[model samples]
Target: MVPPLALDIDGTLTTPEGTIAPRAFPLLAAWEAPVVLATGKAFPYPVALCQFVGIPERAIAENGGVALVDGHLDYAGDPERVDAAVEAFEERGGDLGWDGVDTVNRWRETEVAVSPTADEELLRDIAAEFDLAVVDSGYAYHLKSPDASKGAALTDVAETLGHDPGEFVAVGDSENDASTFAVAGESYAVANADETAKRAADRVLDRGYVDGTLDALRAIRDRAKNGE
Candidate 1:
């Protein structure tokens, strides 16, 4: 049987330029086992991704602050603390690093996503004050509840789907994906992965971005065939 999959979005499924790779659609849709999209992006983002990819709507969104599994919605991270953290950040003369309307976080439900262009140190400090954690997704900096993490969401979703967390293989490429790497039975980081993610993964692929994801998928298929 094919191993279940938990994949990160930004640097794993998308191109270096951040657009979803066109090739991923058919492969993901045709896969026999469950495919869960785990990302720091908002809930709607991954939900829509599943729809477009022609897969079941299984997603861990907002850095695990929110999750949707077969129509069952679960929420973690505290939006109140996120609001406080944002207020503190602004008070310290920090910008969420967006001009005008802050669309990056407009539709976000449970946590706040800040631009990587913002002051990382300041964001971390404010997050600490608000009892939140800061995760650098390579695309953005997310301020979220310490209680939220991709690993936790994966565990929950796996159980709900009648599988063990260790039955899934994970693929990702950033600091935010580290939690998932720690929990998956097998984990791969793309060549472009951040140092934190590389150290956490079971294997680091030679290819980057979408190519790396394809490589990981091939490896998984080989493993299944060889019964390894």
Candidate 2:
């Protein structure tokens, strides 16, 4: 049996404006393998996606910091790690912008979104100083728990399903997807992906954003079903 397929949302499976490609739905429905939506998008977002693609309710949200498994929230690992990290971030004079920590709660389970103005240099500094991972997701910077990551979340889902990470395919298109690309047996990047994402990917699709994602998903389903 093929292992599960993990996908990112914002620049991978969906357009930046949150549109799902028309062709993606049928292809996803036809595929026998579990297609896990591993995304930074919050709860109801995935609910809408499930309705769109006709896939299972399982999803990795908040950049893998939270999981919705069989219609319940599965907080990954210890809760104290998240608390300590947030406290330390605050102590260091980290300005979470206007919304403050409430913005983090909105993502569900306390994964904070740093200011969009916080660039890679600042992220690196925060990471080095706080011993926390700052995931750069284009529109926002995510201050995540130490255990939270796309790859780690994918691993958790795969293990729960009794599958090996080496057998799974991952599709994504940003800095947050770095670890995910590293872990998956196969990795793909959309045409609109950043230079770093393209470099990390095993295959870069010709299509762009939602359309590209639809094309890629169709290709994966075809290849998986027919051994093409």
Winning candidate number (lDDT): 1
Model 2 residue runs over 4 Å out of place are 1-3, 16-18, 70-73, 77-94, 98-105, 118-127
How do the residues 1-228 of candidate 2 rate in per-residue lDDT, one tens digit apiece?
344678888877666676666666787776687788887766567667876778888788888877765656666634455457656656666655546345535645646666675444645565666566667787577776667777887777777777777777888888777778888899888888888788989999898787777776667766666876
For each candidate, what TM-score against the reference? 0.97, 0.81
Question: Compared to the true structure, candidate 1 yields what TM-score?
Answer: 0.97
What's the C-alpha lDDT at position 189 in model 1? Answer: 95
Per residue, candidate 1 scores C-alpha lDDT tens digits across 1-228 of 689999999999999888899798888998889999999998889999999999999999998899899989999978998898899999998888878887788889888888878999999999888888988888899889999999999999999999999989999999989999888998999999999999999999999999999988976777777988
